[model samples]
Target: MTEPRTPKWRALADAVRRQIEDGTYPQGDALPQLKPAAEAAGVSYETMRAAYKALESEGLVRSVKRTGFLVLEAPGRRRVTRDTTVTRDPARGYIFPAAARPDEPWQVHGRPFRALVPAPAEVARHFGIEPGTETLRRRRVTSPAGEPPFQLVDTWISPAAVEDAPQVAEASTGPGGYLDRLEEAGHGPIGWEETIRARMPDREETQLLAISTAMPIVETTIVGTSAQTSRPIEVTIRVIPADRVELVSKLQRARTARWPVAPVKPT
Candidate 1:
């Protein structure tokens, strides 16, 4: 007796999974379009969608609107570094990190807005200054290419840091950005304090982010400190979509766990 044949979509998904594992379809690469793939396979569009959906469920691929089934990421375990804007590279020193791989690189969504504005309460607290103090507010929207904007960053830079590094007040701070300039201005050995909060977005935030009011946002506040004088130098607040990214924190052991042996005298 003949055995039951595998479903067309199931067979297609299995084939794709093999191709993905063998590097035939690398990360950021797109699979064939649904209609075309279905026609080529002599199957319906729904069948093709099922195949792609199966791959998505297995973390082998993802469906992007206006884009075909694209490989989400490479085959490996990934970790995220949720530091302040300053990412340390061995060759580059401190630089702003990219949100996506080279194939789909991150881009500043539009021209950044910079001006001296009254400090937010949290920024004042971090800087140990009076609320409403004037500070340079640098605001920018950023996202991966062809993707909806995911983050809005507002960096509040103290006047003292700007005074030390005049370039920090300029439109461009060379390649390494303000952190490098800050370090050059005798603020070496910089440290960071990060805190996270969650709340519903207001009208402006919802419109700028293009997310629904029902969706909450993740607020990450990073305070950069001068290790020498132990003073806060910069305070950056990042508003991010809650579901888009993973935030990881490193845990350090204060003391090792110990277990006592049973008393010999009792025995």
Candidate 2:
């Protein structure tokens, strides 16, 4: 039996993927028009369009209406390490020690918006409250200096946790941010749990992140509990662009003494 030939679009997509991987179309480079690429690949215009769509789905390129397709930063190059440890400073609020560097100082522009909307099912569960229960919500977009936004965080706090500290609902929560305010309100975070997921962006997310709908995104849900009561005090949903950042987890194994060498046996 004769072997079946691969689909034209599939073959073209493979060729483009190779070029992207080999840095032929380096990051931020614009690809040729569909007609030109189609001629070069000796395929129909529709087939070339399919190939571009495939690249977009793979997150290798993005179509910008009139601007055509542009290469995206490869996943391997841009990484933002996230340490398991959560440290707090008297001057800075919550600090990710792994992400901080002296040369690239981080800048935060918080645009806090308050809402009394019903909590999402997952958020309600984390807060141990009934679904659709009204809660205080603060949405913030945080970014680093000279770069696009790092993440979008939507924090939901139980009314009891922020009753005494109304400032927590505002954009600027003094020096220590919301955690400090919560501490003063007698609901400090002693432990945290985070869940991470990867998926495509929604319409609003695409615009906010300045990315195409085809790009993948990382969604992290963080729950903070009180040290004294072990009750959930805060739940935050953070959305990060996959191309701009990477997540890392560090673990340290316990040390053990070396065992004595045994006599060698002939095989």
Best by TM-score: 2
Best by lDDT: 2
Badly placed stretches (over 4 Å) of model 2 are: 1-7, 10-45, 63-76, 80-82, 107-112, 255-267
- Model 1 CA deviation exceeding 4 Å by range: 1-87, 90-92, 95-104, 248-267
Extract clashing residue pairs from model 2: 80-246
**lDDT by residue (tens digit), candidate 1, 143-195:** 77666677899998888887888887778878777888899889987888778
Residue range with the least summed lDDT across 10 consecutive positions in model 1: 74-83
Q: Give the TM-score of candidate 2.
A: 0.72
Q: Which pairs clash in model 1?
A: none
Question: Could you report the Cα RMSD, in angstroms, for every candidate shown?
Answer: 9.1, 4.9
Instruction: State model 1's lDDT.
Output: 0.76
